[model samples]
Target: MNIDDLVKGIAAGERRALARGITLVESSREDHRAQATALLAALPKEREALRIGLSGTPGVGKSTFIESFGMMLIAQGLRVAVLAIDPSSSRSGGSILGDKTRMDLLSREKDAFIRPSPSQTHLGGVARRTREAVALCEAAGFDVVLIETVGVGQSETVVAEMSDVFLLLLAPAGGDELQGVKRGIMEMADIIVVNKADGDLKPAASRTCADYAGALRLLRKRPQDPDGFPKAMMVSALQESGLSETWGEVQALTDWRRANGFWARARAAQARYWFEQTVKHTLLAQLEAPKAKAALSELSDLVAQGAIDPTKAAQDFVAQLER
Candidate 1:
């Protein structure tokens, strides 16, 4: 389809058109690339949607949380789009796309779109095509975009790079699990939520929240919003308690970022980072094919055989390109 027609259809909030838009951006064809860029350029320039990142341990009920939260938002007359990324199965190397099933209620909402993508060899827990998907969402008029990341270590930071608000979700447990999470991820959180706070687990969740609040006090708080608190909260996804509080906290975060200029900066930085990564990956791909790849393979064999040192081989390869 032509770029103008595609862009018009997407702007009209046609779900199929939006999916096709993302697919075009992901395509490797040169004509598709040009069409994608032009189509994106033709869309609204300054997007005002909220980009939120949700990440936690694998069993921390992330999908359930999203289902509840997204449904709440949709009920409030807000348009929500969830860009949920499920990790590729290590054995089968495919995404089950189970988040859609987990969020059955939210999946059926007309104003809500839940797109499950495979976290395919990207730096963070997100799929490499996530940025394009996000842009498409923004252009298609989603007021909020929630990007869920995999539970991989340091993956939270990757989510933070693209989101205006970075929320770190945690189960109400202490000890080695907390230690397994890196301190750097802790510092990036604008909000920390302790899940499973209802029924028999309320006290445990409360204590965990206190402990996290104390820990957060030692680190620098992110620049404050007029209404938001940087403190931790205890939530129970199963009981739907504290879900409204969590949503309120996120709203404050969104307002602060948009008001205090952090929102624009965050989006701009994300764009620059993605552009640089795309270029670097593209260049590496160009050099790793056919003749260039075969020559590099020979150099590796030579280095292993002690015919040439690793550094010398690298330098010779660079010189060969110049010649």
Candidate 2:
């Protein structure tokens, strides 16, 4: 692939070129990794887009909410990109990649770009290359980039590192359900949205939203937010109700952060974070090399046979690497 031509195309906001760019970043091949690195380095850094991370459990209607939200953004004359992470099977390493299909209307929009990627057993509820993909989208001139996680869990907080606004989507549930939700993920959320707030469920959704609002009040206020922030609201993605209000809140929070100098600081911190993560991941990848794999196999046998404890075996392996 001609990196120069690809860069030109991306600068011109070509969707096809942007898609190929994301594919290049997601590839695991050594050559692809080098090209992806160059592609990222060559892209303009001044171009910026609002990065929103959306997380929720399986039945919480994340896809529906994203579709409605993306359409709304498009109607407002903004080019929107959606990176939906689908859960991959640990054994088969396969994903359904059905987010695009679920968002049929948004997928057909000329101003909307939707990309579904496999989680590949990544614990963060996002693909390993998602950060790079977001960069690609920004370079392609997207006004907003929405990252949809695989599902909400304890480790899903990792998305907070990449997103400017982290939205936690929830469904109408009983009081006990509120207690069951993990506090760690709750603390990471910038906005807690109770979805499906229409029909007979509207009352239940209102009650759930109130419960979450109260819960947010109990948690210590984060310095990065303005007054009355990290709050809860209700939205009906199916009926397209309350979506504009949610978007308004998101913009309000983001604008506040940008004005308070939190935005640039947060982005700088995120860059440093990804740099350290890259070093760790590169070191781990070395273990897959032929010689390293052989040594690891031998050490595994020794540990399994009880000749060496796992910790000692791991230490010896590290020592060999040091040599």
Candidate 3:
């Protein structure tokens, strides 16, 4: 397909083109990387969608919640795109990518698009191509882009860096639950929602909300959150209750950050972070070239045998690369 046609199709919200664009960026081939870079450069500089990062502990019903939340957004006439990051099998390097099946209703909506990418060897619970996928979605005129993490350790902090609003979902549990989550992750949350707040879990969900609200009070607020500390609420994604209110909170926080100039600053910082990551990745890839790899192996053998000091060996490797 012509690259110009692909870019135009994406800007016009052609679903097939958007899917292909995402695939292009996710590929690791050098040619694909060049194409992806050109595609990103063609995209508009201004953000056209709200980037939301949703994360939680395992079994928090993140998929179900996103299905419901995404439907709600669609009903409001918003075009929603979901980039669901699924864990890859360490042995096989494959993922189920079953989020579409899990979010059947939302997936069927013409105004909604869902793509599940494997988090293959990428830490922080997100797919390595997530940032690029988000850019494609925004360029495709998606009004809201939701990034769902794999619910692994440290994922919340990582996703928080990429999103306009970071929402932490919790199950209806007690203070013991709080103990398991990192404080830094909690502090990063712009909003917190206790899911499954229906039936027998309703009371517990309310209590959990209160517990989180209290805990948030004790933590220092992020400088970007001029509206004060994070807000906690209860929602029953299955019953589809409190979803509107939750969305309202998200919008309110987004508005607050934009009004305070924090949004622009945060995006600038994210760009810098990604730029540094690209440079590091490029340098590491260069170090894996055949000649460099052979040199590294020799250095490793020397260091392991104590024939040369580790620090000196590293210096020698750098010198060789320079030469």
lDDT tens digits by residue: candidate 2, 34-102: 999999999988899999999988889999999999999999999999999999998999999999999
Candidate 1 per-residue C-alpha lDDT over 40-97 given as tens digits, one digit per residue, 9 for 90 to 100: 7898755567888888888888888888888888888899999888888767777777
- lDDT against the true structure, per candidate, is 0.80, 0.92, 0.88
lDDT at residue 109 of model 3 (Cα atoms): 93
Measured with C-alpha atoms, the lDDT of residue 41 in candidate 3 is 91
Q: Count the backbone clashes (under 3 Å) in each candidate.
A: 0, 0, 0
After superposing candidate 1 on the true structure, give the runs of residues whose Cα lies further than 4 Å from its correct spot. Answer: 28-34, 90-92, 175-182, 223-229, 321-323
lDDT of 3 by residue, 37-130 (tens): 9988997666579999999888899999999999999999999999999999999999999888999899989999999999997888788889
Per-model TM-score, in order, reads 0.90, 0.97, 0.95
Give the Å shift of residue 259 in candidate 2. 0.9
lDDT ranking, high to low:
2, 3, 1
Q: With candidate 3 superimposed using the best TM-score fit, by how many Å does residue 67's alpha carbon deviate from the native?
A: 0.6
Error of 1 at 20 (Å): 1.6
- Local error of candidate 2 at residue 225 (angstroms): 0.9
The best candidate in terms of TM-score: 2
Superior by TM-score: candidate 1 or candidate 2: 2
Best model number under lDDT:
2
